[model samples]
Target: MLKIGPIFNYLQDMADKDASRMEMSIPQLMEKGYTWVLHRYHLSMIRYPKLDEALSIRTWHSPYKNLYSLRAFEMTTSFGEVLAKATTSWIIINYSTKRPMRLDRHVTSQYYKEIIPFEFDFSSLSPLERIDLEDIYPVRIRDLDINNHVNNAVYVEWAAETVPTNILQSMRPSEIDVIFKEQLTYGEKAVVQTQKEKTASNVFDHVILRESDAREITRIRTSWKNMPL
Candidate 1:
């Protein structure tokens, strides 16, 4: 139901917005060349949109400072139903030192002028459980990236491939929150561990690990919805 390209575009646009806010607070300092670098990001999508649906996004900086800046985003349908929510963690880094810098007073005050409040208890997110999932297809040489490691984005591609064929064709993964725990060296085989939880609905948790050592490489949580197949 979600359009992959557009969702990616939205993420980029939001990044730009966050950057612009940062720039406004310290034009001179920012102009002198210090900037922020993302350290972690997490996205949780509940439902995907049907074709031609208009949506709105709202974001605000949370309370964390310096070593971590918490930004939360919510996407909603035209009728105001919430579609997805995501959180990103960032750090201020000295370009020259390549080390993280404390968020000076000015930057913090500027962004959190109107902080939005939300309750998120990550402790209950459910541990990395296991389930029976389809085997990962072969990883080709081309699948490797410039770092001599598997590309982070490739995890999304692989997870999408493992969805049921019928589900794969009809719905797009509206939201995915991925955590990169480690890197995969060249030719490292990956095994996917998955779990499905249901109360009123089904939620999925998947972990990708090195096939040989069984070390976790990354975890991806994807949410799906129904549309005409």
Candidate 2:
């Protein structure tokens, strides 16, 4: 019962562990009133690994700019079969002041820089259309991170909740690209607008907005494939 949810959760976990050992750990950053915030996440899956499969993930990092860094992960089976590729972009900001922090060269230099990263192009995704599915998701206490905002990774679940039940039952999402636009607090509710288009693939595009003013929250485009395992 592997789901896309775990794809991100596990990847984030591994990144934290590896970074901690290299001195860029989350705990260390929080002490300075600075923490990384995920702005983009893109994942492409060649196949889903079974529960019994023994998999390994190799990660590459790049310091994209003075304020932001990029990381990519390649998931593979023990036998060398590639399962998926994931890339994310993050920025460090002081939560209290809500200002972006300058890059710490000492930290960025620790990760190997040669691994190529998959670039995300938002313009290529289908434009937002009439809402086919709209729902309100409550922000749970557990979803809040040290930043006191909803964890960016949980936004995937909010978007996935709007997927049509029929599609969820028949297809598995093989690709996902998301952009985080706004932050949500504990009592706030996320109103999601989702549309499914038929082309070469069933492309689902979602526009998550704040209920109060209809301000954009997040944008996600997901493409699904038949269960090919």
Q: Of the candidates shown, which would achieve the greatest lDDT relative to the real structure? A: 2
- How close is every model to the real structure, measured as TM-score? 0.61, 0.88
Candidate 2, pairs of clashing residues: none
Assess the local accuracy of residue 35 in candidate 2 as a C-alpha lDDT between 0 and 100.
75
Question: What does the lDDT come to for candidate 1?
Answer: 0.63
What are the root-mean-square deviations of the candidates from the true structure over C-alphas?
5.5, 2.5
Worst 10 residues of 2 by lDDT: 106-115
Give the number of the best model, judged by TM-score: 2
Query: Which segments of model 2 are wrong by more than 4 Å?
Result: 104-127, 198-200
Question: Which residue pairs collide in model 1, if any?
Answer: 1-172, 43-177
